[model samples]
Target chain A: MNNAANIAVDIAIILVLIAGISRFRTPAGARFGNAMAALALLFAVAVALYRNPMLSSNATLAAFALAASSLAAWRVSAKINMTRIPSLVAFQNGAGGLAALLVAIVEMSGAGPAPGAVASAAAAVSVSLGAATFSGSMIASLKLSGKIRQTPTVVPGHNIALLFLSAACAAAAALLFAPGDPTSALVSLAFLSLAFGALFSIRIGGADMPVLISFLNAATGMAAAFCGIVIQNRLLIACGAVVASSGFILTMVMCRAMNRSLMNIIVGGKAPARPPASSPATASSPELTAAPPAPVAASQPEQPAADPLSLAADALRAAKKLIVIPGYGMAIAQAQSETVALAGMLEQAGTEVKYAVHPVAGRMPGHMHVLLAEADVDYDKLFEMDDINAEFAETDVALIVGACDVVNPAAKEKEGTPISGMPVLNAGDARSVIVCNFDDKPGYSGVPNPLYERPNAILLFGDAKATLASLIAKLK
Target chain B: MSDLLVMLVVFTASSAIGYVMISKVPQRLHTPLMSMTNAISASTIIAALLLFSSKLDSPHKVLAAAAVALAAFNVIGGFTVTGRMLKMFKKQ
Candidate 1:
């Protein structure tokens, strides 16, 4: 295909990808769609580059390069667990930045001196921005991946140094492209830029790397866009623009997840507080080694001797305001449909129903949101932690289905616990708390919850799907 | 081209090493590790900028300069941020 046709195909594929990943807040058919779109993009790249005379001349080398980069990306995506996700994202940003830097270099180095002053300026900005983002992203990835300590590695007067470097870079850029000694001035600009990138990244903390990665991703996209304008490449322009917009959106989402601002993270500010150290005395529990307990609380909450049927009947009869808290276990059990059915039954019985969402409830962010969305839960019914915490006071029954960490009162009551400062759902505040899970083990943060011992909390220990299904049948 | 290959190999190897270390280290080490990686990225910027000088008035120089600036930002800013975060741990 020719350039125009190639542009059309690329745009179409990109649109499909964008549409697929657009609903960032929920789990939908989007991930699958994105995978398919990625495949299509690969095909398009193959066709476009293969058809181009310049690229086609060294087809084998180009193919190898493309394959290597794609494989690197795929490996990172597939292998990165939650803890390593920030690093992988940072690496991806670096890749994008590197690509933009390459584009700018190719354009600026080969262009005639008269490619217009505007193009030169665009080229300069692209080169500088791309380099900064590339290095910054790599640093962020390294920090998040645990290759470096999550602390400031700066010398004194870092801000003043940055200001000077910025001034020098601008001066150098102007001189390099002027009537005299362009080469020497450009060389100096390169040196100052290098110092700037290193100094900028060495000052941030590790916990903030996620936000940094997001911001750098946006920066890399902007660099690519600038490079595209320098080279007059429509396809690059669109790709860069999409990446820039999506990066911004994702950055905003990440900030919300961390309860932080983009500027604060970028400016090298600290987190609000340190994560409390793991409690050595209470850290390891016998629950991890031994058989898990049954549905009743072992401590404070006394179990009624009623059978499952009687318990279900009581729940159906007594529940006037009911809330369901979903977790990773719900996703693992695929109990969303059954839970929704149970909710529907309770609603018909005149019990008000809602879902409480804790920010970091699941294996990944939005884990519960994805499962519930699959069951066609209304978006408006999902309440964020702060909004839902107050509702627990008037709640008649809080059915915490497969949730652990998010509902654990340990976040507030227990000092020096792993997740002490993290926010948690106030399920224990409800009149009745019913926890359904297969095990008594604490969650990823490794903290035992006091919510389990609450006066009204009941441990409905069983297969979550089976329990929910039975509850739905009983309610009907 | 050979230098680029070397940088790629170094990064790839460093990434592999990082993955192995993440699960083993204490959480307190996270910032310092990140700082080291930031330095490596700065190195990449330096190499790219040097290449830019050779390309002179060509379009490739622009790309090299961008890479250098980004690396500078990451290294300098990352250290400052990490220092502040570490203070929280120290105070407690």
Candidate 2:
């Protein structure tokens, strides 16, 4: 019966994995996948109950506690704001890591001081990595929620501190391998891991948050997998392996999108300073200077600032092909619905409307897509950076709504800029560019955008949603 | 195969399969992909359940209980959040 149950559990896990994969193929598939996942959970629970030898009073008490905590966590997650989803993800990853850490501790304590070398080593690795993931993810969540500052908080001699922490963890693990009381060493290992997680995570700046979150997610999965090894749990080993690998792939994707080194993100420091503007002008490359200069009228003041709303309305009235670009600012101002409304209005007026999205545009990956999807924006009308970049030249109006870094021309014109070498949308290629941003502030990277200085660009200074709502009203 | 060896094979095969499966996901669905994987990670609740049911001393029992609570929280919260998020992605 035990053998049959084991095989059944394994098959159920395989089915769950298949369902997870099928979710990507279609919307209906996603719904089915979610159902399969619930079924798999029920199967796992049933198998666990069947295999359990002790139905003692202690077990019942533990089960009740488990039910209460899980119910509370579910309630909190269901009520969380959509904008704060990244932080919620971070918190859940932290919870997984904490569970792994506790499991490792319990397994080690049950085995007593002189556990076998293999068990000891597994426990050591699981405890250290799990503790690290828990604390690191907590700090990431705090930063995302604005409870903590988002800038890199590097201590003096941060590298030396990290090296010392690594050495301590290694020493603790080695002590556990030796045949002796490992309790003190385990405690020290947990302490060092927690400290290292906080130190490492807080040093990362806000701009690299997506990469950091993905990396920590992978680390938590790896920790859970190691915990499974220590405890000999096949289900954890299978699920953790899947999460760890996928998270690793996602981390690599995020790094590639930013054109940043993974090691650089981990070490956590400011990007190289851009060259000063006063330096003898390097011959601007042909592609960099390709956008036609905004025509200046001789009779106008030295820097004529066009009235943004009128300019945007005029461009929209004349536009044949219109493209909207959104970024983190759009998320901040809750402008997605307004932006979609504007797009719909433009489409009604015999203009073709599309949205161009940068992969890492908002606080998390696919953030803009979710926001626009919530507003009932047509998915087919949305285009990724690579797909839409070439279409900008043929566009009559590139309506840049609360976007800065992705459309900034500095990525092309200058070297050593924070966003240099990162792929950017070609908003500058349009016949007219209308920017709906309150100010000419540098974005998360803190590199000033030159797109605002372009002559064909008109800046509308106001909150994004309000600005878009007014534009929609004017167009109507 | 030895238990450890069987686990190693399972780990390697599953990881490779996961990479291939997740890579096919569109960029627009990345967030849901993450939340769904998170739900999967909660499978460690099985380990916690077994630990709680196994024979142990008083201190170990307390620790085991804590692990069960944490793992259960992960499982319930993760699946619920993923379901809520996926429901929001309906085509209008």
Instruction: Indicate which candidate wins on lDDT.
Output: 2
Candidate 1 structure quality by residue, lDDT tens digits, B1-92: 34233323432432333333322322122222232222222222223323333324424444444444444443333333323222222210
Query: Lowest summed lDDT over 10 consecutive residues: which window, candidate 2 chain B?
Result: B83-92
The TM-score leader among the candidates is: 2
Which segments of candidate 2 are over 4 A away from where they belong? A1-5, A111-114, A273-306
DockQ of 2: 0.64
Q: Please give the lDDT score at residue B3 for candidate 1.
A: 28
lDDT of 2 by residue, A244-275 (tens): 98789888888898888899778746575333
- lDDT of the candidates, in the order given: 0.55, 0.78
Per-residue C-alpha lDDT of model 1 across residues A1-476, encoded as one tens digit per residue: 23567656755754554443332222223234334434443443344344443323333433344345435434444443333434654665575566555655554545345545655676677777776876776777677566887565667898889899999889977864676434465456656766777678777653344455546655765675566556444334444455455445445654665444666655645533333444432344334212223343243145634453445446656899999998767766768788888887778878898999765454223445545654667756777777779999998888888888678788778876655666778889988777777556565445766776655655666689987777666666
* TM-scores of all predicted structures: 0.54, 0.91
Record all residue pairs in model 2 with backbone atoms less than 3 Å apart, i.e. clashing.
A294-A455
Lowest summed lDDT window (length 10), candidate 2 chain A:
A285-294
